[model samples]
Target chain A: MKKEHFQENCYVSGHTACAGCGQSMAVRIVMNTAGKDTIASNATGCLEVFSSKAPESAFGVPWIHSLFENSAAVASGVETALVHQGKKEGINVIAQAGDGGTADIGLQALSGMLERGHDVLFVCYDNEAYMNTGIQRSGSTPFSASTTTSPSGKHSTGNPRPKKPMVEICAAHHIPYSATSSIANPKDIEIKVKKALKIKGPKYLQIHVPCPLGWRSDPSQSIDVAKKAVETGLYPIVEYEYGKLTKSRKISSPKPVSEYLKLQGRFRHLLKDAKALAEVQQVADKNIEYYGLK
Target chain B: MAQAAKLCRPGVIAAYPITPQTHIVENLSQFIADGELDAKSVNVESEHSAASCVLGSQAAGVRSFTCSSSQGLILMSEVLFCIAGMRLPVMLVCANRALSAPINIWNDQQDSIAVRDAGWIQLYAENNQEAVDLIIASHKIAEDPKVMLPAMVCVDGFILTHGMEVVDIPEQKDVDEFLPPYNPPYKLDPKNPMSFGLLGTPDVYLETRYAIQKTLGDVLKMIPTVGKEYQDKFGRDSLRLIEEYKTDDAETILIAMGSVCGTIKDVVDSQRKQGKKVGLLKIVSYRPFPKQAIKKALDSAKNIGVIDKDISLGSDGALYSEVKSVISSDKKISGFIAGLGGRDIKAKTVEEIINLSEKEENSCRFIDLNKNILWEEFKTI
Candidate 1:
């Protein structure tokens, strides 16, 4: 689809999102695709708090602000209502949550909604930490990433655990649709979203959205950083259906893990420590071999 | 005419059966099944789904109903706040029962008392007639445009809920005349689409809560008007908020809620015949607290004994503390914990408490204290 054909006017715009925030860009692009017929349920996070401050909402479409953990549940209720009333044809229900909201607090409700098979699209805009609450490490935060809560110090290393494989969790539910997309590739996101809309049951799409504010990178380098995550096999774009992995975007000449790590200050400490760097490379290789990205 | 006035209104009802509270759902289900009530009946899997079903249906601009008790209420607690916060005006019939520790199923106000801050308007019934009538009145009050909050008619489990009595169930025409079709401010209309519960930042979060608070606070004013309007048609003038029994010439009063009020009233009548200066004050509205009416009822009493079926843990009984907060500092108030976990709160126990209040020595006591199985003396057991 042509970029101009995508709705020029988005539901959320002219907000105080930091310059080149991947979440803000993804919201704009996704809402544009979702159009006016969408009722967006946003978890309490940066996107929700920044855009839809009451009396002055950036959204043109119907939007709900729900608790951080229950955006999916709230959207399920909304979808159930719409379906019961026989008004589900044109109206689309979309639940958008950040990494912390989706991967941590909102996981149970999300799982419940998916298991219940509500006809709603849940979008996890993964910026990798609780950015709205000041760069705290979340379940989606990568290993060796230096977040405020998981800071590297004399006594401790950065985040010690690997990022949770959310796509596998969604796939385990035997959901009709689950995909990993990225703001770095808007076309992939747009295609996955359109494909998800055609499915009859709960659909999940986790978009790799880099946050310059939280990732400690140059604001302009957000998209580049996101792309490197894909190219280095740290974040492979994959899709699944009926409990089976169906498609994956393969990377030609996959870069070493160091290429992705050196760009962000969160991973800067790992460069000086060979042990930490080796562990990071092991995670990258595991993701590459698991997704069959190469 | 009274039979016509008590007919079921047109709407959708989804419910589940819980112990002690099953009768309310059973009666409503029968009403729908018999073709007397023009409503859709959904037999949900659990109280949580029952709440969700009604909330969803109500959001679609349809009036809906559900009922539950104790553990069931707690199971549906999360969705209760959702329905109220969304301003859906859904009405529920709550057969108040004791919460689980030992898991005994019996009559008590503990169930509804635990959910006191859930933003739903709670109206307690003293008898079967009030149980049926209050359910009708709650629909009217909740659906009022000025007070678009969820309402629960709390009937004592097994006591008023299961106990059969002569209730004048109104006819369909009277119900239609009294309760109007639900026309929500913003529903899930495809043509005129709007968000129901949108996220708000610090810029507008406080205002949303304030709006709900103000609406709830102002809803008390509409209760009397709505109550009076119902009475004009039904010929029963039920108290809109709190009911006082023999409170006029009493030196000592027992303040309680739910069906225990009936037990206390019985105790009060026999005590009054013997020239005892004891009275009973029954709290009808638990949410919004009925603070002003509570203060007025206990204003002249020398000693106020509060009987609570619900414990607040770390503190005394929940209602006792709420009542104490409303009364003047100089007033002597006693907090007694009774009927917890569905333990029997007999009339004799209430009568003994009332008599004890007259002595002016022991202020508070736990009724039916099992001394043999005491925790302090249980090491050798």
Candidate 2:
């Protein structure tokens, strides 16, 4: 009923997440904003694993987990059921998955849900890699970020592929709402969720949650690292409504991507290579131009 | 079957186009479009999403339905296990078809049989009438308080899906009287919230699995009760776990499932006229396998032949293996692989198996398979 009630009544405490789990924090903000009248279909990921480990659960709201790739489909089902029971009046349906679940295994399902115009909010807690599966590289992993699957070895660098453009993909579906947020600004997450919830159709919110364990960032500076990601114009906080860009979190005092890269060990190797650092800087410059973050 | 679904009043129907299963969904879609069935029809892109959508709907405390076959079933295989594991009771109709590789789109038991281990209660149909009956019965069994497990009502691909037979589709009013409204034991309600389908560690993973297995074991007893209730309401008696025919003084019996059983029955009646003392045992329930019923049905037989439309590659037939394990008789029951890839199981094939069961020293036999054609490739390999 109230904004604070979401935090108090939705996702509760008591689980075994790592010290700096941005997925948990971003998810808490997302679920809390979703309020008490919400049912979540979660994909297999850090949030799914940490929040509700059998016999004990941190969730105060009703939640379910299907496969990693089918959360949107499952949520579509839940939404239909709610409407059938005439309970969709106040109930909010949310599907949450990690980066890999979203940009890779779950993309088709997400696209299907959006195209069907189902009233559900899909949240992708972008931790960059598969942290729940022991830090494997995922589709959401940034280029040159080290992961177990994409090691920065003598002969090779880390991931060579750029992070999949998930927000653009959501917009391509011509859905009612799509947004990018950062856990550093929990208010932004809360604002986007409130805005998206009121619009009745498929909505996507990709929150840049800095995973300290996966990214090799400082546990205490997880929020700070996330802030730097947005401040550097690399992870732009923007919103779109029905395919038109509506809002962009301005980069008034723009910093280099080096500042963001320095905070995480995943990009630690990039610091020494000027060519890699310039490549990462070019990514930031492109985002600034494309999103008008400047 | 579509009428049965309409009667049950499924809240959501996920329709994905696939062979054999397409006609069933098309009928439902037409019904919904005409306002005959008040249900949300989600035209999902794939079978995987179809399964997931139903799983979500059931988890959200409403009844839902979906159907598929062959490659579609294989596509849905992943979500099938998830629904069962999460204990969300779903009613899935699998029009069984053969797997591709010759890319054949025809009848066989391979589709549903392939997912036997996915933790759904599988019911085989002998005809279109039986298929319709099992649809309503499966919903009852799946929603039973004691048996909160998913169920699959399987009809042979084209044999029953394409074949039109007279079925007394239950009236909406009567069905409403029979089946209670969807009030899930645990639902995603904000008023009374609870977490579901959590990550299970090694300490509790096996325990969660054992819980489902225990519930499946519990289904063994509840199926007959539910079957009896469905019979009482619908006035159909043979929807029982197994359909037994003239095994009283039989020396040899033939065991099979789905529409092929109809042909087997015709053969058994003729064999009885010759005073051959042969019978047919049609297994209706495959999962929570009716072991006691199976043993009781063929208890008097001196020899038994298990007919399977789907082979398990290097092993024998899927049902044949299960039947052999539970028979309590000597491992002497012969396994016959027949009617694969939509190949018709003529009365002659049934007669051949009956004769083979009598004389053969228990072994696997590929009935009607041309050895010269099949073995030619084997010779090269």
Candidate 3:
């Protein structure tokens, strides 16, 4: 089961996370690819909660965890300080946060960092909902997905809004680099981090990590669920340079949207509602058209 | 304050534009642009980012600075607590101003007072000289090996920030000897890897707070030595937590902080000529509360009055509450809230405050208030 690409795993041992947590894997790949010369500012979330439990840390790299809303802003500070020491060239600064931190509370700071062109890489681990806060609906949550706060009932169809265009939002800032990545594609995760580290200005890479706890999916099926999300054309693995879409991972076997949704309990109610299921399929169809998925 | 920053030579300055606070950062930017200061300056998007920028740089072990006032201070309050809780020695200047809702942009201490327990060493400057001197001394006090907590020097918005004065600017070499380089014991280093400001479980969270509180107590003792050292080296008396102004043999004393102390002192001098037994006690450091010095300063006075430019809403002024807690005596100390939202506090107001305290029992008094206007609003409500 070993992938073609492997890293040194900057996110080390002695931590608490679900056995098959895809987000933790993404953290490992991103940081390892960022290398030993990286200093990180992490936001408060499951990553922060599990990695640091007082007097013990899972981070093998030099890291700092500030409030959830200021991780990117703090990274901007770290970058400027490196500039002061004439060490910006030698060190790489990275910001790590969950979907809630990136798309909602931390968005302003992220936009500011990108607009100001601080030489730092911002990595948003998009696990759909605020999984750490008991599966509350976040801006990045997919449409009709059942989160604790957005539960399906007689009057409700879970989240009414579609998934936030996080990568597009980063591109809108006209940053030097922006891309979509996932743990399912470990090669892409490492490749994007390597590419971002080489860029001289603000760059963003958002990895669509599947949360087994929030998704109510089988823990062992995390990789399958992540792979199915891409194969179904629901989550595009695309890259943008300076706001222009330059590259996208071609989907050769575009599975029906049901292949992805049927695996997770969050979307189980959609099976009974044909109209809602069609709405979800239409979203995947549009992504397939836009991304030119085969 | 900007000149003091220039002398201290922080590695980075992160600032956002806020009224009364804008000029300090503007000048820092101008210095960096003019090739006068070698530090990297960031005109951040908001006070929150400005504070985060400092947090980031300070974690990297490079000294940094930021400034804000009123709404800007409130915006930065979240990160203010983060900087202290993280145990980083960052410097922030609070150009003290009144909070909004009425949208006033005048001098008041409400903004800084609101974040009193944010774990920062809060110092108030009475005039331009103290503003300049305290800003210079802040780096030393905050960067003390024992006390790595951040410190904020609050200069009244418009009063010290806009009001010009002749300040004795210290030489760069002297400040260098005084502050040296900010070589923190621990820093964000790639080689010697470590995590900072990590999550504290309930097991260790209380101890972290206890450590900061104990370090703050250590600051009260260490800060005076820093001021004394500044005096010995530069021939200027600095670093006093509180300054006593003619309190000896006085029947009543007026205690205050920030620029209003100057007006109180002027009133005290004139009242002395009229054979009035009145004195002034100025609080230079508000965070540590300086209980010992406050007690010693107001010992001889039979009656006490506290002038606060900031209040704690339902309760009286914050200073009034703390002063009352420290001095557990039968002597009544009247609290007056005045000069709010940048309203003027003339010498006559100081005289009236002293006069009222001598005649009345302890209570919260509003100075220079238009009662008719307030009553009109009440009728409309």
B1-381 per-residue lDDT for model 2 (tens digits): 787777888888996999888988999999999999888899998999999999988888888899999999999999999989888889989988889898888999998988999889999989888887888877877887767888899988888888878888877777887788777678778787777787778998898778888887877787778778878888986457788888888779889998998998899898888888999888888887888888888888889999998888988888888888877656358999898898988999888888889886555677786656766666442
TM per candidate: 0.87, 0.96, 0.97
The DockQ-based order of candidates, best leading, equals: 3, 2, 1
Model 3 lDDT per residue over B333-354, tens place: 9999999998899999998999
Best by TM-score: 3
Give Cα distance to truth, residue B173, candidate 1, Å.
4.9
Stretches > 4 Å off in candidate 3: A1-8, B376-381
The best-first sequence of candidates by TM-score reads 3, 2, 1
How large an RMSD does model 2 have?
Answer: 2.3
**How does the DockQ of candidate 3 come out?**
0.85
Q: After superposition, how far is residue A146 of candidate 1 from its true place, in Å?
A: 2.3
Q: For residues A1-294, what per-residue lDDT tens digits would candidate 1 score against the true structure?
A: 122332455454567788989998888878878777887777889987677555556666666664666677657666766764567788888888998889897787788778878889999999999999899999999998999999998866699899999998998999999999998899888888889988888999999998998898889988899999999999989999978999999997889889999999999998988988999889888888988988
As a whole number from 0 to 100, the lDDT of residue B60 in candidate 1 is 62
Candidate 3 Cα lDDT to native: 0.89
lDDT of 2 by residue, A1-294 (tens): 323543565775566788988888877788788888888889988888777777777776788897899999999999998887788878889998988899999989989999998999999989898888889998999888889999988865789888899998899788889999998899989999999899898999999998888888889999999999999999988888889898898989889899999988898988889998999899899999999997
lDDT per model vs. reference? 0.79, 0.86, 0.89
Model 1 segments beyond 4 Å from truth? A1-8, B1-86, B93-108, B157-173, B188-210, B234-239, B275-277, B295-303, B313-316, B324-332, B361-363, B377-381
Prediction 1 TM-score vs. true:
0.87
- Please provide, for model 1 over B1-381, each residue's C-alpha lDDT reduced to its tens digit, 9 standing for 90 to 100: 112212545366666788876755666667657866666565655676677667766776777777788999998888788788888888887878877777878777777887878889988888878876777777787888878899888878777766778877766677778877777777765455455565555777678678888988887777777889989988876637888889987889999888788888888899889998889998888876778988998877988899888787777888888888888887678888887766777888997787666666333467778877788765343
